[model samples]
Target: MRVEPAALEQAASKAGALENELRSVDVALHTTAAVRGLAGWETARRLEQVQSRLQDLVTGLANRLGGVSERLAATARNYRDSDEAVRRRFDDGR
Candidate 1:
C-alpha cells in the first residue's frame, strides 16, 4: 500500500479543526446548561436534562475526533520515518 504522508497530515489537520469546532459547541452547550430560573419547574428540569445529554454527545464526538487526529498524525510520522530510512539506505549504497 502506498502512503501519502502529506495527505495523512492534511487529514489530521482537518480532524483537529473539527475537534476544535466541536469543543466550541460543547462550550456553548455548557453555557446554556448553566442558565438558572424556575429550578423547581418540571419543564426547566427537562430542558436541563436535554442540554446535559446534548453536551455529553458533543463531548464524546470531540474526543473521538481528537483520537482520529492523533492517529493520523502518528501514521504520517511513521510513513515519513520509513521513507527517510529508505532514502538513507539508497544513499549508503552509492
Candidate 2:
C-alpha cells in the first residue's frame, strides 16, 4: 500500500484551516453582544440557550478538527520516516 505523504500533508493543512475558521466563528459568536439584547422574555431566554448550545457545538467541532489535523500530520511524518529508512537500507545494500 503506497501512502502519499504529500497528500496527507495537504489534508492536514486543510483540516488545520477548518479548525482555525471554526475557532474564529466560535470567538465571534461568544464576543457578539447583540444576541443578548435587553429583553427578559421567555423567548429571549430560549434564544440565549440556543446560542450557548451552538457555541458549544462549534467549539467541539473545532477541537475535533484540531485533533484530526494533528493525527494526519503525524501520519505523514511517520510515512516519510519509513520511506527514508527504506531508501537508506537500499542504498547501503548497493
All candidates: TM-score: 0.81, 0.87
**What is each predicted model's overall lDDT from 0 to 1?**
0.87, 0.86
Model 1, 1-94: lDDT tens digits are 8889999999999999999998888544454544565466777777777878888898999999999999999999999999999999999999
Candidate 2 per-residue C-alpha lDDT over 39-82 given as tens digits, one digit per residue, 9 for 90 to 100: 76676676677788888899999999999999999999999999
- lDDT of candidate 2 at residue 70, scale 0 to 100: 99
Task: Give the poorly placed runs of model 2, Cα more than 4 Å off.
Answer: 26-38
What does each candidate score in C-alpha RMSD?
Answer: 2.7, 2.3
lDDT minimum window of 10 residues, candidate 1? 26-35
Superposed model 1: Cα runs more than 4 Å off: 26-40
